[model samples]
Every structure is written in structure tokens, then in C-alpha cells.
Target chain A: MAVAIAEARIGKWGERYYSGRVLQLLERGLIAFRSSTWMIVFSGFFEPVLYLLSFGYGIGKLLPTIDVGGETVKYAVFIAPALLATSAMNGAIYDSTMNVFFKLNHDRIYHGMLATSMGPLDVALGEISWALIRGLSYACAFMAVVAPLGLIPSMWGYLAIPAAVLIAFGFASIGMALTSYMKSFQQLEIINMFLLPMFLFSGSFYPLSVFPEWLQFTVNLFPLTHAINLVRGLCLGHINVALAGHAMYFVIMIICGLFFTTRRLNALFMK
Target chain B: MPESLIHARGLTKKFGDFVAVNGIDFDVHKGESFGLLGPNGAGKSTAMRMIGATSSRDAGVLTILGKDPDKHGPQIRAHLGVVPQQDNLDMQLSVSENLYIYGRYFGLPRAFVKGKIEELLTFAQLEEKRDAKVEALSGGMKRRLTIARALVSEPEILMLDEPTTGLDPQARHILWDRLFRLKEQGVTLLITTHFMDEAEQLCDRLIVMDKGSIMAEGSPASLIKDYSSKEVLEVRFGSDRNQELAEKLRTLCERIEELPDRILMYTEDGEALLGQIYASGMHPKTSLVRRSSLEDVFLRLTGRTLIE
Candidate 1:
């Protein structure tokens, strides 16, 4: 009798509750995640913290103080937000690209999922949200590492959680969108070619002002630069008009990336 | 007419310029077991995908459970159970977990799915292997688990494509028995296979297809009756001399099919045909007689063997 009731309800539940359907996708993702050991999750937390320890304290004594916005601050304070922004971007990109690519290709996980009540958009949104969850946890872990070193001083730093999620969403959606165009895992080298440049040139290691006049404009064009500037400005209590500009850039980026990702996934999977 | 659970009229599909399924028509009624019998590359799977609503038809109209698939894909799919030709199980998860997650995919509540897994494990005969990862199972077990996963939502129509193509004989019989139970329970089945014995055993009505077109459509027994004689006389005079002896024994039976290894004579009376062949002063190395089957139906319709 219960089986009949469930079967009867199956036909009545589709389309009206798309969120419930997408949530099913997230639930599936978590099921796969649970099958793995905890060692991978622990490792995601420590890589950024290890980088922070190496760069924040190991090199801070040499640089002494740095000027962020108008106020002078310890070198550790200036770099922590940049590290957080990059950490969020890296975590989101790796999850959305490598993990997603494996499931899309070798595992054919989405192929099986789509054969059910789920659609392509459900898969895209579900995977991007899970990547954001991973990115947010890593950002929080990075903050815990640097907070003991007295790096985060401003109350505006509390906004880091949402900011980290926004940055992660911007990168993760775009990464998923790019992966749909890929034919094989061999094309994944393109992601490395893209991210390595953005990581090195997006003002993660230094201020955009350090670049030459023409190079500074090019540096600001990168999404990570906007993420780093927005996050750094908030962490240091340096509120300014440029902060709104960076925030708007990511908002538009998130919308556009999500739009393209949904369309691309539909084409690749729904055929 | 009985209402069809699946209906397709002039349905077609193409990949680039190559036509995969070219303007085929078939209807599968509720509570009936229907099949598409064809060899490899005969466009059977493409038709299955379009019927399953995973692949849209290139042309024509399709309705599943009284709803157009183009407009209500997810809703239509909710009521469908598709066991694809390949088993795409999640290797990272356990057998019970695979069933649980698929139930959730249909928006079944967690508590309901948890209880459902125990019954499904027993149904698939995987109760001992419930906690085992999907990758650790044998091919037959994985296929059974896939079929069980498709049943989690209690679908109205179960589509199995080449369901027993890779299984051993015993495994095939086991899977067939499970599917037979589902049919007896009045679940509509849409199966595609190149195996004639499977079709004869399982399908109530089926279509013979070759190169993207239906050659003939009828029940298995009716098809064999329409396309072939009641019985077949098989005589193997060694591979080298079967062709030479086929001409000598032509008058003994109404029709004789000269294959490479054996000569098969189609006649109404197998015992009389075999005795007449023996009296023809030509002694073959071996002789036997049997009733005609779906294999003969397919061969008569398409001029090609079903197994390829």
C-alpha cells in the first residue's frame, strides 16, 4: 500500500517543485561524498593554512608593514584576505572542474542521474552549490589559521563568509561552464593554463598599484583581482567606492556563469 | 482498442546526416510485454532512448502515459524505469546506497527509501551483497541491481535495452525470471534484444527490425507461423559438401536454406522430411529436426540472421 502511494505521488510531484528535485541532486552528491574517506576533506583545509603560515609569518618579518588603501598595516594583515580569496577560488575551481569532469566523463554519474527525474539544470546547480560548500569551509579554516596571528582586525571582516561564497560561486559556475565544452579529460590542461595565470597575476601576491599603468588595467580585468580587492578592503576596514564596483562585477559574473553553465549542461547531457 | 502506455507515430532520429531510426511506428499497450527484436546497429536502442524521453525524436509525435514527452519530460520520466544497455552504477557507493539514492532522485522521502532498500535487495537477490560497493559485484549482479534501482520509484513502464546481452546462460535465466514476475504484476515492459530465444520466451508481441525499419510485427508464434514452416529439418553433410547436397535434396522439402555449416529444410512434417531426405541417396554427417522459432521469422523477413 505504501509503495502504491509513493508510485501515485511520483507523477504528481514533478516540475511544480523544481527546488525539491535539485535538492535531490545535492543529496545524491553528498551520498557520493560520504563514500569517500575523511582524509580528502581534512587535506583541503590544511593546504591554504600551510601557505598562510609560510607567507604570512615566514616572510612578514622582512616586509615589515605595507600600505593597504590609505592606512599602514602589518604585512600579514594585507596578505590574509588575498590568500582567503584565492583559497576560495582554488577550492571552488578544483571541485567544480576536476571532480565534476570525472563524474561527467569516466563515472557517467550525471548520465545516470539525468535518466531519473533530474534535469541538466538540477545537476549544474547542485554541483555548483556543493562546491561552494567546500569553498566556504576552506575559507573558514584559513581564517582560523590567520586569526591567531592577529591578521583580521576589522569588524567588516565578518562579511568574509558570504564574500567567500560569492567568489567561489563566480569561479565554480564558470569552471563548470568551461568544462561542458571540453571533449575529454586531456583538455583539462586548459584549466591549468587559465587558473595559473589568474592566480599569479590577479593581485593575490601584491597590490595592483605595483603593476605599470597599462599592466594595472589588465590586472584589474581579472575576476580574482576584484574578489581580492573587495575581500581585502572589507577585512582592513577600508570602505570605498571601488568596493561596490568589485561586488557588482562578481554579481554579474555569477549570473552570467550560471546562465551559460545551465545551457551548456543541457546541451551536453540532455541530448 | 486498449490504451497504449507508449505510442510513437512516424518517429525518426538522425546523427548528422546518418539516419539512426527512420520513421518507425509502434505502440506498447499497458499490461502487455512488447519487444523490438533486431541485430546490432538496427536502431533499436535509439528508439528506446526516444521512448524513454532521454533523447528527443528528430520528427513525429510521441505520447507516454497520455502525456506528450516533449512537454512533460520529467513528469513522464518519473513514471518510467529505464535499464540502459550498459550498467551505469555508482561504483563509489554500496548496493543498498545505490537503491536509496535513486529513490531520493524521484523525491521519495528518506524514511520511505530506507525501508524500500531492504525489499529491493531481496528482490534483486543481493541481500548478502547489500553493503558491498557496486564495483565489487559481478556483471550479472550489477545488472540486477540496476534493474532494481529503476524500480525504486515504482514506475509504470519498465524499459530494458539488450538486458541480457552480456550475461551467462544461468544469469540470463535468473534475470528473465525476475522480469517475468514484473510482467505478471501487470507492469508494461518494452524490451529490445537480438536474442531470439529471449524474445520467444518473454515478448507477447514484437517487431522485427533491420537497418532502421520494421520488417514485420506480430506475436512470436504468429510470426514464425506466417514467415516459416511448422518444423525444420537440419542436415549437416560437413561444411564442404552441404551446398552440393542442398541441390540434390531440394525436391524433398518445400524450402531449404543453405547456410555455410548446415542445410536446413523447412517443411510441415519434420519426421517425414527427415525420412525423405535419407531416401534421397545422400547421407549427411548429422541429421535432426525441430520446430521453427523467432530466429527463422527474423531470417525470413530480413534475409539476415538475428544474431548477426
Candidate 2:
């Protein structure tokens, strides 16, 4: 009976979800990343860091050290955490959306992956994990650069790394879910149109309160708004109970996004 | 043959309004090579997909490995391996990595897959190409690698869709040899193909299908025997005047068919028919007598050529 249970546990369909296959996909993803390591390493780490050097030192020198929510904070202090949020969102959304779509359509990688015991759920989860790993890496590097520059106001900023991962995961899951429905390259332009504007206007560069009341309400609906605010709150060492609401928003988004993405992937590939 | 390993009744698959597989029922016994043979759009691949538990059946009593595919797809699929018509290998990975990752999908430990990878590569004759990327391999090598990858889980049944289509004659023969070895090891094979030669070479029992339904079912030899006469006489006349000669040659054969390219006479002995044609003073450009084959069976059932 024990032998039979062991066999059943290690059986075929059960096998696809095993840590071994997940590890293999993770290893393959990391290996593939190595092939283009320079692109990810430079783009993920340097882009946010470059923005810090350029704007924090170059632009912030001209802007007065402003009072944010009653505390006198440097202009760089206010913007660095927002950069962290945007970088995390960028890392997650880009990898999960465009890269996943290319592998699904042109490379036929998902087709090959599905031919194994790995179901659509496994692929969705695996890709999202990679996105979070990438997002966390970028968040850490950006934090390191900003820390030496005295941009981090308190130790609560360390919590921003995991927060960035959650933020990125929510976007990555939703991005992959949306990518599953897209058919043509021309249609992907719509995603760029949506993503770029959200990055520009959704409080990544400025406070949401700077916008008109109506515009603030509109941008509030965007996932990145909550993510940026959460990181910003943490970075400035302002621990507010309202931060729980932001955390809940990302948690809910991750759940729904993962659920929807898995469903969409299965519907598309398991036919 | 013991109880049927695969049993289906009223199995159907409809894509929107167009019915792809319309209510087919069949069972596969253990350790048998069963085939679904048909032309280009015959739902053979769809049927194979349903049996492989990768596609859903709209309505049916379907059981694979004693489980309902609708509720137990992964369970059913775990015991089965499928090679789709196209070679969907991971172009980024080395040939061995393809097999290794596939084995990992079945949740095999790395050490187990490491040993199996070498054995599988040797079996596929890809030992030298193990480290080469999939994009660098030849077409036949890719197909062999696909088959090897499917075998990584050591499945009980293997499903191949058009396993040898588009392959050169030598490659096709080599694939057939490998498949025959698998059969000798008592692994059941369910194959779908439009190629008559492939069906005849690999299938033990086959169902000829057309337009999403089975037209006939029997052993390859029995199918040829039941649907076709012993021999066929091919006659090509000098010109359009061939029609006039065809009119005169009706009395010399059992059944006469006038095709755009040539005339076919289905008879017991083509030599006697050719002699009668010669003695009757009807001259033709060329004539030949050949034994009827699965090609004849296809032509007789579909009223068209097989390769088309």
C-alpha cells in the first residue's frame, strides 16, 4: 500500500507540478537570461540608477528640497522610491508580456512546454516567479544606489524590495493574461500605448495629488498607483495603517491575475 | 486481448458549428498498433488529440487508461506520450536538453533524467548531436529528437500524428524501423497519417477515415483485398483519341475507369486484358500491369488519387 501511494504521488500528471520541472524551467529561464544577460543587467539595474544620478543629482539640485507631508525631504528622496516602483513594474510587465508572447507565438515554446506534463498553470506560475525574481533584483540594486545617495530616509525602505516583488507580480500576471488574448504584432502596440502612459502619468514621476482631482481619481484605478504609493510610504519611513489597504490591493490583484492568466493560458494552449 | 485499454462511444468534437469529429466509437486493445488513415482534413489528428487527452470531447463516453479525459486529463496524459504532426522542439536548447527537460516535466529526478538522456540520445542516434542546438539539427534529426523527447517519460502508449510525413524515403524507413522496435517491446502505438505507405508499413489494424468519419476498418492487407481486385492495368492512349479506344476496351475488362491522365482497368489478370487490347487492334502509347495496393484502396474509396 505504501508503494502504491508512492507511485501515485510520483505519477504522470502529478509530475508536471513537481519542484523538479519548475526548477528546470527556472534554470532554463536563467540560462536564457544569461544569453542576453547584459540587456537585463544593464536595463534593469542601470536605468533606475541612471535616473537617480541624472535627476537626483542633476535635476534635484535645481529643485528646492521640498516638504513632503510635513517632513522636509530632498527632491531625490521623494522621486527615488517612485523610480523603484516603476522599475519593478517595468521589469515584471515587459518580461511577462512581450517575452511570453514571443515565446508563445513565434518560438512555439509554450506549445513545446505544454506537450510535457507541465500544464498552463505551471507555465503561468513559473514565468511570474521569474518576473518577480527579476523585479526584486532591480529593486535591490536601485535601493543600494539610492541608499548611498541618502535617498532612503529609514530602514522601512528595506521592506520595499518585497513590496516591489508583489507590485511586479500583480502587473506580470495581468500582462501575461492580456498577452494570451492578443493575436498579431499590430495588436501589441495597444499594450505599449497603455503601459507607457501609465508609467509616465501614474505617479511614478510625481505625486498623484499634483494632478487635478478628476485625473487623480482616474489614475488611482491603475495598479501601479497603489504600488508606487506603498513603496513611497515605506521609503520615507512613514508607517501608516492605510498601507495595509495598498498591500491588500496588490494581494487581490495577484490572485485574480494569476487565476485569470492560468485560465486564459489553458484555454489557448490546451485545445 | 484482455479488456480494452481504450474505449470510446459516441465521441464527438465540434469547433463552433463545424464538426471536426462526429460521433466515432472504437477501442484499442493493449499492445496493438492502431491507425487512423485518411486524407488532409479527416479529423484523424483531432481524434488522436482527444485520445491523447490534450483536447476536449464535446460529447462521448471516452475512457483512456480507465479515466475520463474531461476530469482526468493530466492523469490520462501522464500515461501517454504524443508526437504532434509538427516537430515542436525547443530551438534554444541542446538536443539532449530537450529530452532532459521533457523528462523533468514528468517529474523525474535530475540523476534519473541524466542517465536516461544518454540512453535516449543513443537510441535516437543523436549521441553526437547531443550538445548541438535544436536549430542546428536536420529535419530527420528533429523528428527523431521529438520522438525521443516523447519517450522521456517512458510512457505506456505513444501517439504519433503523421510520424513520417515530409521525410525522405531513407528517413521514413529508419523511423519505421525504430517504431517497429518500440512495438516489439509491447508499447501500444496510435498513429494518424494520410500517407498510405506509412500506414501500411506501421499499422497493424487501421480505420480509413474521410470528412471526420471512418470509411473502413481492417488490417492493411485485408483492406486492400476487400476493396480492390488482384491487379490493375494502366493504359495511356496516344492522344484525346484515347476516349475512342476506351469505348472499344470495355468488353475486355471487369471495370473500366477513364481518368484525365490515363485509363484504369480493374480485372483479375491485367496481362490477359492487355493481350485482348493488343489483339483487338487498339494501339496505346504505354501499358503496364501492377498489383493493387493501399493506394488503390484509397483511390477506390475516395474516387481520387492518394497523394493529392
Q: In candidate 1, which residue ranges exceed 4 Å CA deviation?
A: A1-19, B238-240
Predicted candidate 2 versus true structure: per-residue lDDT over A1-271, tens digit per residue? 1112214644554343332245667776776675444576567777887787787778687985866667888888988998899889888888888888888888788777776555677788888888888998888888777898788988999999999998998889888888888898678788888877887888765567788999999998888788888998899988998788888898998898888887787677667
- Provide TM-scores for the models: 0.93, 0.93
Tens digit of lDDT per residue, candidate 1, span B114-228? 9889888988999999999998998899999999999988888999999998899999999999999999999999999999999999999999888998999999999998999
Query: What's the DockQ for every one of the candidates?
Result: 0.46, 0.38
- RMSD (Cα, Å) for all candidates, in order, is 2.8, 2.9
Best by DockQ: 1
For model 1, what is the error of residue A31's alpha carbon versus the real structure, in angstroms, after optimal superposition? 2.5
In model 2, the runs with Cα more than 4 Å from the true position are A1-21, A35-38, B238-247
Per-candidate clashes come to 0, 0
- Evaluated on chain B only, candidate 2 has a TM-score of 0.95
TM-score of chain B of 1: 0.98
Q: Which candidate ranks first by lDDT, i.e. highest? A: 1
